[model samples]
Target: MIDKSDVETNVVVITGAAGLIGKAFVRAVAQTGAIVIAADIDLSAAEVVANDLQDLGKVETAYLDITCPKSVDILIADLMDKHGRIDAVVNNAYPRNANYGRKLEEVTYADFSENMNLHLGGCFLIAQKFCAAFKAQGFGNVVNMSSIYGVIAPRFEVYDGTAMTMPVEYAAIKSAVLHLTKYFAQYFKGTGIRVNAISPGGIFADQPKSFLDAYGSRCAGKGMLDPQDIANTLVFLLSDQSRYITGQNLIVDDGYAL
Candidate 1:
């Protein structure tokens, strides 16, 4: 039997809860009766999100700089003190440098390394600190936000007419996230903690029509997904419905990676 009651009382921390997908995740999770802490680097934006969804469920805003160890540690400590326990954490923060989407040849080594440190490194720090905290508490859940690019080679043809090209750093970070999910799940075996990853395809963000058509041709349906599509999957992972699933990557790309 599903633990619907337990799902209602979950206290989930969603990092980067102010971004496009992050906002949807906050709304979806909040609607499920979980107390959601919408943590983000932009405090005001996160607060706006919280206020907008206040009627949905329990939504709180907190400043979270995933790149900083001190920042990650502080949020964990404060939440533990206030809530007594953190039932789950979604590592959805997307940290990157100014030159993030540069084409392959145009990307500098410094830029690549910096982007890696910001995004992948941030994911690592969050998982490391939170898993340790989960260990002490004896139970927890972790959901890392990866990308479809992580699971398959980039189809550079899709970005042909546009100035857009998949960043190599993104592929590296997200792919690493997939492995990290497996690593944590295996390492924490028998502990009441579970870890998993979500690899979403290109989200509908008003890209050029040419790019959309090109990308759409490769999908089974709806080429570009809405943020809610991914958020729905996240709710499942956080809820008891997916209790026995762990260390797996759920791709919600409308079959783009097919």
Candidate 2:
């Protein structure tokens, strides 16, 4: 039997490690004894996240601009030089333009294209570069952060009283990410590489009470998830326990997508 504690020695890279879900992933992976790279475009924020989790385990910070190929290359190179091997990478960055989040009717083509390029394009670049490194190393794991909205259409009724509407670009990007996971998994079938995605439900971010209630009605329990909820699932995917699972999208949306 493989000792799960062996994961403690693994080097894990999680992009967007300063953000909500990203921070949870960093904490969870660090707690497992893995050396975690809390990477984000905001170096200071990533450092703060690493500092907070240092006592739990080995946590490092790095500047990672997911949309920039040069930045991604540098990060991969630096980590390789320092850690010797990268066991897993979490494609969890969420990049977008200033004009993002507008309603469908208000969305411009330029805004949509730019947001897609930033978020989805960045996702592709991260997976491409990391998977290539994994191939050379002979083994690796990848976990992507998709959304429940990608699994199903937006429940627009939940936003009836809130100032939020599902961004069209988000739906497109996430849905494509699901397929992308499968693509990477299939393309690397013979290689010792595994690729998967996590589609999380709406995370609790202190939204309007009305919005929460409307959203809650759709869920069987805990309509809005905490960051840890999704993080736990990611840990499972990164572990050897899921060694045989690949080319899959695990939905962690608490039945909300049903």
Candidate 3:
């Protein structure tokens, strides 16, 4: 009975809109006629994405530093003033400083804590505030961005000669995100809000041929994925068709997790 047509019934907020995956999501959602808020810490980059998507549908750019409580407060207030309602939120961000992605031996306690606070903590803050608002309004959806690493350990063999090695913080943070999705889904049991997560595999970003070959061997077909692959799955989760789905972690990894 929901107006699933492109009638601007949904005001979707997406963090990390500057990244490849986030940008792809913005485009996909905008084309569906949702009032897309292409939010990112980098205001300029978010604006760029919003500008590109304006031709397709109603899209706006907003600054969001999810790690900061005040920034989160302002984003919600601003969105409320402009749109009056938020139908869904996509916690698709990876806020990090330079200390990330260091080798196992080089990582410090400070690095691990910082990454978790920004990534995991941010998701919590966003979900908490949105769930409260959604409870009052009586409907909402949340999609947390998780990783395939969270579902299965990394294949160290894939990075044998490449400069790429999985970041310890990422695995920990993503695992938490997946569990948090389940927690919130159960916690908001009676509320009309639904919480879910998506775990994506290695996306094709022009990696080295050797790395691609190694990774491909582990996948069902293509070793690496396109940003659109993840975006497509998100569309289904955000729509009314998925109204009955919640607290589930959908993996879009070309059978890599299997």
Scored by lDDT, the top model is 1
TM-score of candidate 1 against the unseen true structure: 0.98
- lDDT winner between 1 and 2, please give it: 1
- Model 2 whole-model lDDT (C-alpha atoms): 0.93
Candidate 3 C-alpha lDDT tens digits along 140-233: 9999999999988878888889888899998998999999999999999888999999999999999999999988898999779999999988
Q: Per-residue lDDT for 157-221 in model 2, tens only?
A: 89997899999999999999999999999999979999999999999999999999998988898
The CA lDDT of each predicted structure is 0.94, 0.93, 0.89
Per candidate, the number of residue pairs that clash is 0, 1, 0
Ranking by lDDT: 1, 2, 3
Clashing pairs in 2: 8-33
- In candidate 3, which residue pairs get closer than 3 Å at backbone N, Cα or C atoms, i.e. clash? none
lDDT of 1 by residue, 1-258 (tens): 335565779899999999999999999988888899999999999999999999999999999999999999999999999999999999999999999999989999999999999999999999999999999999999999999999999999999989999999999999999999999999997899999999999999999999999999989978899999898899889988898999999999888888
Better of 1 and 3 by lDDT: 1
Which whole-number lDDT from 0 to 100 does residue 223 have in model 2?
Answer: 90
Write down the lDDT that model 3 would get. 0.89
